[model samples]
Target: MAGRAGDRAPKARRIRLGNREVVTEGLELSFWADISHRCMTASWPAFIGGAALVFIVFNGFFALLYWFGDQPISNVPRGAYIDYLYFSIETLSTAGYGDMHPQSHYGHFIAAVELFTGIFSMSLMTGLIFARFSRPSARLLFADNPVISTHEGRQTLMIRLANERHNIIANATAQLWVFKSGVSKEGVPYRRFYDLPLIRSQSPALALSWTVFHVIDEASPLHGLDAAGLKAANVGLGLMVSGYDDVAAQTVHARKSYEHDQIRFGHRYVEILRVTEDGLRIDYSRFHETVEG
Candidate 1:
């Protein structure tokens, strides 16, 4: 029912980092080798369904063993496969009803093994569930596109992000890096990374939204580079933000990447902060919207 690696389906995976798609093949990963990682990353429904399937298969396997034995169970009718299956379920779950039980020595040995397996599996499942729920995660929302426009009489590249949780992130720090592909003087191809300096990279407490600005001056790596020039050079950008979350009591980090084509030249983000009758409000509906400058 399964094909070899060379048959047709090669071991390949397509991973999306930012807007870039990278294809990797020939990685022979064993499912059992990374079972814990796979289970932890799996969706709620998938994880639960897989656990249920395993439980059923385990009981079914023991049921066949009980069916082969001579008078394995007392209350089960002779030649009734379903009754043996039901008895197997009861024994494996440790829900032994007095009505059905092991009668022969062979049945007793199988039931003993099933009881041990039931206890071990239930403990493992409990640990996995606890680990999944205790994992730390961030709720940072990044704008879809980075905009370039004039700010403070200089061309500026701006990226906006918000705290979806509306909780304080203390000592939040941000970094921006630009990636460019070029040929070395020795005629070798290479991709280089350059840090882009932001106007203000640190915040005492980030509660709502923050806009980071990188002025493209003569000293800047992005200076004299238009959208077309960036694309020609195969330029890309990555942003990283990290801080201690007061609510979660842990350090959380978020990252976003933008390809050259996703960069918007001569554009600015729509204003989202406004004064309301009650108080100052931030309209996040237009957070990702930009207008031509």
Candidate 2:
């Protein structure tokens, strides 16, 4: 009876990006089953470390093979593991200095194998490095929290962002989405997504700062949502910005999400722009700062 009950139990879902939950019903394979994708998507340190480890391990394996062979390498000190290891490195890198050459048939076979492996490994590493370096990324800085404040005599939801690189992003576009738990008319619980219409979603040129606003009017999805109501509904907001980076000559994208607790009611962003004697100035220290509305 216990086994049967366990089998009937529903699996827990995970929320990713706003309130999007992944349904795992009937799923057989885990996402981690693919190692190549993981390596490609892993951090820089991890990828580089893995590459170094592979190089060391491959060289060590070849060195052991040479050490076990019978007088295979010429001019290598007898029974000297270090000499064998150096020979292995030279063979694997195709950097034969001609000082130490393979003499026996066994030595030539091992050298050929190591050389082939070296070429393949080097090509794979070069492709991965190129892919990682060529990938396009954006450096947009989002405010720590979203604020609800008065804008144009109406309450509005606002999120601020700044270009950390201070480079022009041409035809930059932004979108705001709201996610909340809701009950259907049939009393079934489900997550809902609402596209919040922003007053200005596109900027011709985003060089410094941009503030996006969604007015909370009668037609707005958050028309009557107060702080408590938002919290109770497990509200989340997702913001996505994409633009053509003139400097990079590529399309760059950025995303940010704010949970219910990170949404501030009746607050306004602190002023960050100022005119200085030298030129215009932007104080990033106050980028995430806010004041009571």
Candidate 3:
């Protein structure tokens, strides 16, 4: 007996947007498997819509249950689904109005169940909303493209970013990484990553703009790589900025990536800082503006 031909081939893995690698061959897990976390992390509109839908559906279901029994809710109009629905809402919210309420053991049991569901659901939704609002996120803005230009009489790789928030971000740090395809000494093709050394990667405070520069000298992996070479090798430059935001009172991070084509050679960023009669003025309209070096 021999194994199947398909089984002999190794599975190919795919790198996703967030650098997450997934094997092509595997048991695909259902999103419902981790529904709690998914709900907590879901977008604002999605989470709110889901909660609204659940609330309506739950009331509708209980209304139908009340309609099935004889006079489950006292003072509700005879055979009126709408009236039963209203009663269900009141019971679920524990807002027992004097006008109508549970009239029998069956009614009491159903109301009890709805009350419990309402409490638990409200608590879960409150926690998720608070988590989303409290999460720390950086508002750093990166330049549209990276540039290569002359700096201090040497060719340098430059990237610019600004802290959009007026508040201070303490102990800010940045890192630049380059990913490119290359052939190993053994003639095997592989993807390689290199950390470019920056002139100044750390900042005590970041309230305005910061320009990061990496000297492309002999020590750099990109020393010999020209624009054409970079394109041929499928280069990608990744920039990461992290800092402790005073206003947020927590660590926040932001990242951006530029492809080979997005790197402009012999180019420099335009000036964005200027002094006005009132005070310092930053023209954000020209933040991404550039000029040929």
lDDT per model vs. reference: 0.92, 0.90, 0.89
Query: Residue-wise lDDT of candidate 2 within 1-293, one digit each (tens)?
Result: 35654465555555354435555554444455986686788899999998899999999999999899998999987658889889988988889999999999999999999999999998888988998899899999999999999999999999999999999999999999998898999999999989999999999999999999999999997889998999889888999999999999999999998888898999999999999999998999999999997
* Residue pairs whose backbone atoms clash in candidate 1: none
> Which candidate leads the pack in TM-score?
1
Name the TM-score of candidate 1: 0.88
* Number of backbone collisions per candidate: 0, 0, 0
Tell me model 3's lDDT, rounded to 2 decimals: 0.89
- What TM-score, over all chains together, does every model reach? 0.88, 0.88, 0.87
Error of 3 at 121 (Å): 0.6
How well is each residue in 188-220 modelled by candidate 1, as lDDT tens digits?
Answer: 999999999999999999999999999999998
Among these predictions, the greatest lDDT belongs to: 1
- Candidate 2 TM-score, true structure as reference: 0.88
Candidate 3 residue 243 Cα shift, in angstroms, is 1.1
Better of 2 and 3 by TM-score: 2
Model 1 regions more than 4 Å off: 1-10
Q: What lDDT tens digits, residue by residue, belong to model 3 across residues 181-230?
A: 98999999999889999999999999999999999999998888888999
**Residue 31 C-alpha lDDT in model 3:** 71
